[model samples]
Target chain A: MTQIVRTPHEGPRAASAKRPGRSAVSRRSVTLITGCVLSGMILLLALVSLFWTPYAPDDTSGGRLTGPGAGHLLGTDKLGRDLFTQLMTGSRIAVEAGLGSVLIAAVAGVTLGVLAAFAQGWLDDTLSAFLDILIAFPTLLLAMLIVAARSATLGSAVLAIGLAQSAVVARVVRILVKRVLAQDYITAARTSGTSWPRIVAGHVLPNIWPTLVVNLALQFGLAVLAEAGLSYLGLGAPPPNASWGRMLQEAQATFTTAPAGALAPGVLLVLLVIGVNLVADGLRDTLDPATGRRRS
Target chain B: MTLLDIRGLTIRTTDGHTLVDDLSLTIAGGERRGLIGESGSGKSLTTLAVLGLLPDGMTATGSIELAGTQIVGAREKHLTRVRGTDAAIVFQEPLTALDPLMRVGRQIAEPLARRRGLKGAELQRAVARALEQVRLPEPDRIARAFPHEISGGQRQRVALAMALACEPKLLIADEPTTALDVSVQADMLDLIDTLVRERDMAVLFVSHDLAVVARVTDRVLVMKDGRAVEEGDVREIVRRPREEYTAALVASARRLESALDTRRAR
Candidate 1:
């Protein structure tokens, strides 16, 4: 009678093959669909903007403060730059920043976490202590420091956000890897002559990825917001790159004359974040190993 | 022809509390030896030590020579090389012993692919055969299903199949039927008996129950409080136990047996 306090999600919790059907299932799908539609809208715009915006984002091709018209579908800003094009391009950047930072975090964090989990006494202690200290440091401030060190550009903002968020990812990964290592199957795998790398690849990674994917998805929204915040502080990719945060900041002065200037980018940013969060929630429902929905 | 030989095997916690005292065991090629002890008597730890898989912070001293490989103080690299091909284990709880996330077929295919270099169509056939050997009906569906999707009996069968995939020299079953129902337990024992006999493999069957051990093994080693109390032929130990601890174990087993017999007769 070894005291193996297995994680609740594992074990005989859902031993029966009862189909999970309820209001909760239907509701999650609803949110999932809505999130997809919202997030898809931004992704579609970003893709389309790659080839075509209403006008060049830097073009002063319309009258200042002009209302939405056939010529400029959204309008023009104080600098007479096409607002529609700016917002479209801004989305591309938003998506880029979100995706970039998330990718970075997933890669760096999972690596550090796996290493720390496998590390022996002194190494494990050192890695864990370092991660804890990083966790205490604010992600945005770390990003800002990276921005300050390098020239204020898109690459630096992305690198900063990604590197800063990796610590959180790594810490979570360490706990997850350790939990997996404690399972009886892990011992079984070892006894079966599964090499360390094979066990990690087969047992460790497969057991952990469902939770990791969802975690990375949620971090996507935060990365988006963090990128925008950087842009607002004039620390994002330079103008014409016109990240939505920069749009919001520039629109701050012209709220009375043309509320759409601030309103458009602000609205898109909120919608995007909401969409990503909802999608993350939807993913959690979908990818949950407990519900046994992720088997295939 | 000795497949497993242990001398002065001792396990201690990092804090210096001894869990398993000086114990010795020897299993010849194709021999079946039963290690009987109640929980905390170090039966399971002995099995783990045989596989060189002692838990972290706990230390094992003294010699454990399995297939001529020294287990005590051996590096993980060398130990891993001896594992599976030399000896494989089926844990007490099949539900947790299995990777719940993996399909049954793939899990069985692991040792086969690793040890025998099976792949693709050949590997699939081997997996199905392993499932079939375990007497799992609908090997196709069961193979595709997850551990939780199958019944507890089927999961244990799958675990046995995985252990036997490469047909190792020895099989260590640590309370293999402890978590199983009585009828299923009988069937699993019968299955293990038939399969191991077919393969001519040695078995280290660890259990707390005398009746369970007697069913599958010829020899039994009675352990109490981390020390070997008595060791003899299974029937001899059960029929006329030597030590007080062993007598208690036999008495309890007899009580359970007659309890069942009376209920059946009545």
Candidate 2:
């Protein structure tokens, strides 16, 4: 057997040389790096807030309406609470909501999507119609209703946002799965005597994962924004917990007098959302077959 | 010993459009047969019916026996067992016939593991041996590479290795070299012919190209519009085609070959 196995010198070298275009690789890498850095900074802020803060987030000892000065990093809010501590804690809340909701959306959406793609005739049509109906209902409004009904807490907000986002994820997943199913390789796998479940595990899921990763990253940003909206409306995370949306709502009245109070949470919220969007953009560039590097 | 026996195999859609109309053929053990027809001539449908892989809403009627086992209307569970073990099919487009994301070795190993229960060192050795049998270079490296990592000819070879891995009694090559270049196509045809001879496997080679069908197959079946118009020895049919359809096909193929030869001479 060893003697029979020939070494073809020309083939492998030619194959390996077929790398992705230079411009495409560089562009994707730049996007991926920028996204990573921005998201990493937000995550770092959240992690740091977990251990320590500049001052007690709820403490009202600092002078009310003071500017940025010694002992006070971002000055104080109208109620004299440490502005920096509140902003840092708000970062943690944003991350939690983003991750939790995205998790929920992924699991439920992927299952429903796969089922719809595999189903035939009426069942497929019905699943697609149901998802369409869900998508038609506005995400924020749906989250608001769920939060109102369930008593707004971190868990409820996460659940509400996740359920609202699942429809969009499901739709994308269904389309991706349907496209993959139509490929010749799937037919080949079927002819190879591989069972449906095994084919899905071995072929279907792996092919669709890159697209799903990119879509889910975009959903993460959407999830964060939705959670913040709910928090601003006083239907997310409650008062005791520092949420960026709630901080923004609280700083609205004192906006003219103390600019930093409104600016601190607002700036951090914008940065985190931008960070997530950049990550999604980078992921799309990296995972897309047309843009990404190929083994050949 | 007849390896496959099909009698009155008619395939039709739910809307009652007949795709394969009462087609019947037989292949004995170690026999090599060619199914020659144009696109939409039901050559693929007939082969797919044998493997119980007809598309949704298409129903296959009449008897399809493989080693005396009924295949038409067989349950999916039983058909799956018969499929990579009793008979295996190598499709036309090597580019798409393989899972792009999966390593070639694991793709080949999957059926072997499922059909033969081979695992660990035994599985690895079996996959390497299969690759070697197809005359692919560096079996270990090729096995580790993804489908897109190899050239078209190499990919087709991998596909052959996968089909032959189970050492099935019957091998169905459904226009397996049609998607390859002219030079590579001959090499693939030679590989299939040599492998079939070595394994003593009954082959049902389907192709629209008369030249390719003639090169590998000993017996030929000429099909047109879902019907078998003629069947005879490969040489006899090519030399003196009985049916008008087969004669036309032979004439066209000859014309094309002669035209190519003239161009080469120029």
Candidate 3:
């Protein structure tokens, strides 16, 4: 019954007040800028692909499989379509798969984690057993099996990737949730007559969010790699539709004839993953109280 | 009339180990009582039982009445209401008792908002008054401060401020001054004692220190091996303890004081 009337800036204000003399913007600017720029580029690519492409990515008359030339920049693929347009459009699928898988993993993992910690006894044991079983299977193998069973649609492919990735998320989340539950603030919230839902939402969720966010960023990078692997193996987005993974598969066939075909998508994939990892590593270092000052 | 009445209370864990047994105690309106026992002697368990805060797997076959309402097997929602209104507990370690993440002002405001439905400026004013009651300097600044930024004594005072914010009929202080230095402990005890006297609030001061119990309580209950072996006036418990356990506790207390006296004399 104790209604906690939140002051608008209570959390941020207290954090800032505690560390006076430092600007909030300066505290996390580098990691924030890198994460934001990469994420923004990924988003822009996805949105732009929905409306238009520079050229018809599947058109034959555009080049008839020619190399890099005027108008047909970055050459053409086996289907005589522009590789640059195809790759640009292909960015959407990679981003979607990565983002989609993360969303699924986050929701499933966090819910299971919080529930397991809060609901002890049978519920906890049951969830723990299930997560253990799920984590034992390799993510790629599981996704492959799922795609084979479900007939390989984009939605099913993402679902497969998500299910594969969620095991790791669940494991990490369980540890963090367990730690958060044991914190004195949680005990204080309980003693204050805060309801169970409020305790989970207000007290539990906010405190565990930093770790979860860092995990999500790290997981997204892995999911992108995983999705790309699946697509290359012919279990990703269906043919005629653009996918970074599918593009990589096509590039492999034409590796000697036009190295850009394989190299462009392959290099982009590596850079994106590295960027994500760098940002994730930076976040992990920044958010951790023990090492945060060292970073500063 | 008694605000809290515990008669023949016994609490046990799932393993059938007795944590508190056959313990009878009472706190009438405006009375201050002390429950003195060393660690693991069940004084803290008795207090938690009164608040209905024993963790799951722990069983209590005891009558814990708060303001005439039995809370031993009360529903959680019912117990929740009882906590902020009828009775509240102040933990020994205030830094841990209050959430480190929350602002001190908001922590104090929780009970008032819960029991009295205070909001906005009224909530702020109530928090300010509670801080003042605990005699915290720069109440406004302290309100904005996180738990870590404050000293141990200040944190305990904040915990006291939180416990008193609801204006409960009875306050259960579980070694509230133990974590503080001797001088700060004295100041904290004085603050709690003065507040209880002024507001006519019954207090259950749980501690291991006999002298501290003697200073603040009218009656003392000495517990050992999860049982209340002796119960009487504070001075009588200190001077003429009947039970061997109580006598041993007093003896140890005297030994510590004489040791300190010897050190100070040099």
Candidate 4:
């Protein structure tokens, strides 16, 4: 019996000769590297804080407004808490809430989005109506409402933010799924004797993953900013616990007396948010097909 | 005796637009029948309906039988067995027909795995043999290469290999060569014709190109307005076409060839 097969070529034969030095760098590389360094530093701080801190971030010092010195590197806050320790400890709250909220939102959104695209009748109508309702409210206000209604804890704040942001993620997923569903490969897959489960798992999911990854990264940065706003407004995870927003709240009163106390945590918060946004932008550039290999 | 039969096959979109209407055709064992028509003449739609592959929102009502088994309007699960096991289609635009992300060899192996329960070494051996039959260079390498990396001609051959993989009794080629360059189109047609003759398989070769229909088919059905207006032996239909539309199509094809001849002479 004769058999049918296709010959495969190894290592991109088309890239021969004229293509030189594949390590060409892009501006995105710089952005990505800088963002990665900032993110890694924050994560390292979180890990270290779980075990120890140089001084208690909430402890009062013997005197007021101690300038930078060996014992107090970033000086001290109004309560005489070590500025360096408070910033380091605050890393846990920022990273966890931002990462956790976006992850939850992505899971809920991607599932609903794919379902809305595939189920075109009453199911589509119902899901889309619910999505519209979610989108109608400002995400921060919705998060605030949820947090206000319940005890404002870290878990509740993250859950509220995730639920509030899910509508945007779902909308993006739905549009992408609709595009994939229209492809000829999908039509061919249906006629090729492949079952729906295999089609969705193998074909649909892989095609949508790049889009989902970029969306998740972007939403994480947004969540970080949103979490900070909540903390500043006193609706964030309540403390003796350190958060950049709660630190900012404390800084507002001491802005006139010791500016460095207000400025230190505020600078760190901006740096973290900038780092996240830069990473998201880099990921979008790299993952997008149109601009993927332009540097090379 | 006929191995596959279609009688009074009609399809209409949900918007009440008729795509294929009262179209009937048949293929006996080892027959090579061509469905020749202009675009929108329902040749492709007729085959899609028979295979239970019309897009969602389109409704098909027809009696279709394959090797003594009825298949028209069968639920998707039942149709799955029939698609690659009993009947397979080689679509137009080979680039789009095969999955872009999958390796060519693995795609050929899929039907065998799904329909016949073949796997592992047996599956690999079957895939290697299928690639060899399609005349692809370095069958092992082609199996690993993605669809986009290969040339258009190679992709069409891969599609042919896939259609022949399951040893299906009936193969449908829907404008299989419409997307290829002229020289490559001739090669693909020859490959398909050779396979149909060797396997003794019934083929529903659909195309808008009358010359292709003439070259590859033993019998021809000329469709217009979703219905077959002329059906006869390929040579008879070409030389003494009964319908006006069939005659016009043949005349236009001859004119096209003459124009090409003039351009080549220059």
Predicted model with the maximum DockQ: 2
**DockQ, computed on Cα atoms, for candidate 3:** 0.30
Please write out the lDDT profile of model 3 over residues B182-248, one tens digit for every residue: 7677777777888888899999999999988887889998888888888999888788989988999
In model 1, the Cα lDDT at residue B53 comes to 94
Better of 1 and 3 by DockQ: 1
Model 1 pairs whose backbones collide: none
- What TM-score, over all chains together, does every model reach? 0.94, 0.94, 0.88, 0.90
Summarize candidate 4's per-residue lDDT along A1-296 as a digit string, tens digits: 23332223222256233222344345667888888887777888888988898887668862567877888887888778887788887888888889889988988998888888888789899999999899888766876788778877777778878987888899888998888777777766666677877888777776777777777877887788788788888777788778888888888887887777778777777777778777777776665433444434
lDDT of 1: 0.88
- Candidate 4 lDDT over B79-183, as tens digits, reads 876777678788898888777657888888877788678889999989989987877777888888777667788888888888888898889899998988776
- Pick by DockQ: 3 or 4, better one: 4
Off by over 4 Å in 1: A1-17, A22-25, A292-296
Ranking of all predicted structures according to lDDT, beginning with the best and ending with the worst:
1, 2, 4, 3
| DockQ, each predicted model | 0.42, 0.51, 0.30, 0.37
**lDDT score, candidate 4, position A195:** 84
lDDT by residue (A1-296, candidate 3, tens digit) is 11222222222233443442455336565766676677667667668878878787677666555788887778888777888788777788878888899999988888777777766888888888888888887877787788778877667778877886677788787888788777666655665566677777766676677678788888888888888888888888887777888888877877888888888788778767766765776666555443443333
Candidate 1 local Cα displacement, residue A12, angstroms: 18
Worst 10 residues of 1 chain B by lDDT: B179-188
Against the true structure, whose lDDT is highest?
Answer: 1
Which candidate do you rate higher for lDDT, 3 or 4? 4
Count of clashes in candidate 3: 0
List iRMS for all predictions.
9.3, 4.1, 9.9, 5.5
Task: Score residue B50 of candidate 3 by CA lDDT.
Answer: 86
